[model samples]
Target: MNFNPVEILGLIAAVFTTSAFLPQVYKTWRSRSAKNLSLTMYLVFFTGVMMWMVYGFLIDSLAVILANIVTGFLTLILIYFKIRYKD
Candidate 1:
């Protein structure tokens, strides 16, 4: 397989930044709690990720688009549970 350093680097960066919220999500789901999780921040982040996904589509970057898609869905799930189980 031919590997392009730049593409690999971009995917790595995307994975890191996009998965940054995973810990919080796991903690919330595991503990069944959403306290201290900022709804506003997640809402804003969701919007941002949605936009990023759109931009990625426009630019024809499947990696970026798919990463953002998954991130966005997870964020939405967290956000939904957060609201449903507010402290």
Candidate 2:
């Protein structure tokens, strides 16, 4: 297998940024506090992710498609928890 530098960077960035949400998710699950979270931000974030997904579709970029797909779900779950357990 061969790794291009840019692709490696993309993969690294994708992993780091995507994994950033894990702690938030775990903490939220443990404490069930959504007050500090922003509803409007998540709504806009979800919309932006959806748009990224669509843009990926239009451009046919695998990296863009994959990252956005995973991030989108992660974001959606947080949003759901935010709604379900808002303070």
Highest lDDT, which number? Answer: 1
TM-scores of the models, in the given order? 0.82, 0.86
The whole-model lDDT of each prediction reads: 0.83, 0.82
TM-score of 2: 0.86
Residue 29 error for model 1, in Å?
1.2
lDDT of 1 by residue, 1-87 (tens): 223786577678778876886887788988888988889999999999999999988877766777798889889989988988878
Q: Which pairs of residues clash in candidate 1, taking residues 3 or more apart in a chain or in different chains?
A: none
Q: How far is each candidate from the true structure, as Cα RMSD in Å? A: 2.5, 2.3
Model 2 spans > 4 angstroms off:
1-3
Write the residue-wise lDDT of candidate 2 on 1-87 in tens digits.
235687677768778878888898888888999889998998999899889878867876666667788888989889999999958
Model 2 steric clash total: 0
